[model samples]
Target: MKEDKRPILVFGATGRQGGAVAEALLKARWPVRAIVRDIAAPKSVALRQAGAELVEGSFADLDTFRAGMDSAHGVFSVLPANLSETEEVRIGCGIADLAAESGVAHLVYSSGASSGDTPTGIARFDAKPRIEAHIRWLPVTATIIRPMIFMDMLINPAFGLSEGRYTFFLRPDQSMQLIAVEDIGKFVAAIFADGIRFSGRTIKIASDTVTGRQLGEIFSEAAGRPVIYSRFADEVLAANSDLGQLAAILDNGPLADHVDLAAMREINPEIISFRAWLATQRHQAFDALIGSDRTSHSA
Candidate 1:
């Protein structure tokens, strides 16, 4: 433990990205204060056990955010998108404004890979570019981390991968960038430690780039079984309007653009490749998708 005394306030503490950041901060011996809507939540308790100071607050409450930002050396902010435009934007901007107002030394805002000049016609993915632009003009030194589509999304319950055949947006030939949730924390922590060098920069964070066919091969090899990948059937997409729209964006849009691996490796030396991740993960959660005996579960 490096005994870094300055505390960093982490938003979305209960979720995957925030949880990873909190854990990484603690392991580095840096003081961490995580904002959670419910302190009683299992994830909150886990954060406390991992040495995070938990604060009960939602992104909607600016007072709570201000309090958390005060005396914080850095802030790690992530906003959840559940098809709600208002909450998502408010949360993302509020944290940036609060961090800037409080004079926090370093602020890291987690955005997504799909965010760019051209609109994807998806509100959630596009909202980030607005938030990123807002953060750029803030007074405090800031860094924007645009992570690629999460690898965890593939294992979600909604995709119906448990049926032996996996369906997604890409054709077998299309390549997509993705990142592991665990890698988010490691990369953010490293940035915090080297704040001077990373300040005022926007960087795309992706672990690996793989095609639809490659995913099938990786999954099949990891599971010791056969798993085939195919584009989402038109019928399935037609029936699910929301998924259909998203799949259209993924298939046609720049969401699957590749990242500069050499530069990313320079930032975080331990970035995990998708195949490496599959080999190391022995948990039963992932087994649902590729195991010999499958179960009925979503993601």
Candidate 2:
């Protein structure tokens, strides 16, 4: 956005969150250098095609990260959720150290809304707080963004959307903030564009907040059929401890009241809501899931 053309080095560019950031940065005319594992991977190739300077590397490889961050303007850090807490923290913190040591101007770390100083007994959520703490000790100007639950999860067939029923961590009347993956990039781009305003702040972002019942209504309207919505059944939760812990968090945890739609709209005005995401970007996926077995099973 200025006369300087240094790129913002982006990690996890092949995945959902990172890819969104990369695309948004490119659209904003900011140069992006994406660190990827497989240079020939489809997502990696696509990044190159989209004007990203792809650098082959892994998160654990310090040499590769140092090289990529060298002389870069900023760094965007996000680790895979499937990783263990120790590994996630190590890589996340290491990136911050590298960014600061590399003289990067700004660092943006993608953390979960439910993540905070208190442990939620969830590994993925707990790891971020550790990473955040590490960044606090560094000299680099950093913005920690806590993104609410993703709207994309609702479309997963395992969640029962393919069968016209969606089970989640909320009661029909209770509300939870949901963010579109597409919106994550916009928020991140804004944070990078203005370091002075967002640095040293932990801002939570969400495009829309909806109750479970509202989700059903939106899905039904989009699918042209009835879609039931309900909280995770007690039996289901008890059967899976991980899901059970997450559901518990939703009931009473950091996730309950994190999103401020008014503030988010101010930062990224084009924030997409659940209905808009379903009607637009996710329509194909929704159609695929609903049409999966619609003709064979008429439940």
Candidate 3:
């Protein structure tokens, strides 16, 4: 089949979610144009090698965003949550506005699981619903994807993987949804391919659901050693209000993912489970973390 000539412009292409979207679009034979702050960066170079056209740009630059969106048929939008909630909302809304003005056919906004019609009292989570509202008001067709917790986050040293114990927000029997970072791209690509089917839809996505104990079991099996799992200790939570708030949100239900895994799999059949994700691209990293005695200061 002849590849689509019109490209899908992707934001944050140097980062995980956008990079995944770019790769998946490329695999599906859709032309991809990635916006990056530096085209010379290693990840940008990798994107170029993978056949993505690189556009130098930052979220703060409207001109760069317009240039990237030029002649684009679709857009995969994602922003880092490291910024203040106000800044996140600004950047996200700005992207949607640009996409609308650029006459982009479809806009897929990657949001967090906690975002919805009501406020979650978490600034980061609330920022997304605001963005979603902005996108809906725009003239352009849009899809909002609320992705569950990332499987990739499990291997982070901050999770105490290096200590043979994983401490997270969920209770021992409490199940949380998770998605492989790579699958985010697959879902985006699918949405872009059939815009009418997904347009105006707010979809929550996940590859697997597991409790804290299940996470420990999976980690132990994958690492060939017994790994323990426990909820964040009281002192630990007290020391970090942000962590405490997140834990409370998880327990209270808004932040806890309730995605339909079977339905998501039907949309993107290659969706990877938590165990599968750890055993694949993350295997080496997970192995290294398990073997190391280095402690992480961040929660």
Best by lDDT: 2
Instruction: Please give the CA lDDT of all the candidate structures.
Output: 0.81, 0.88, 0.85
**Deviation of model 3 at 283, angstroms:** 2.2
Clashes of 1: 3
User: How high a TM-score does candidate 2 get?
Assistant: 0.94
Task: Show the lowest summed lDDT stretch of 10 residues, model 3.
Answer: 290-299
Clashing pairs in 3: none
Q: Write the per-residue lDDT of candidate 3 for residues 1-299, one digit (tens) a residue.
A: 26545899998888899988998999999999999888898988999999999999876666678888889998888998687899999999999999999998899999988876777677878898899989999999999998988887777888997888999988899988888889999999888888899989999988888999999988887767778999999898989988888887788756665877789988999888787777666756876888754232211
lDDT of 3 at 164: 83
Question: In candidate 1, where is summed lDDT lowest over 10 consecutive residues?
Answer: 290-299
Instruction: Candidate 1: list runs displaced more than 4 Å.
Output: 1-4, 157-160, 233-244, 291-299
lDDT tens string, model 1, 1-299? Answer: 45546799998888889988998888778899999999998888988988899888865567777888888999999887673666677778878888888999999999988788887767888888888988988788999998888877777655555666667777898888888888899899999999999999888898888998998877766666677788888888899877787776677665756788878888778888887776674346568655555332212
User: Cα RMSD (Å) between model 2 and the true structure?
Assistant: 3.2
Per-residue C-alpha lDDT of model 2 across residues 145-248, encoded as one tens digit per residue:
99999988878888898877988888999988989999999999999888899989998899998988998988777777898988888998999989988887
TM-score, ranked from best to worst: 2, 3, 1
* TM-score for each candidate, following the candidate numbering: 0.89, 0.94, 0.92
Q: Count the backbone clashes (under 3 Å) in each candidate.
A: 3, 0, 0
Clashing pairs in 1: 156-299, 157-298, 157-299
Better of 2 and 3 by lDDT: 2
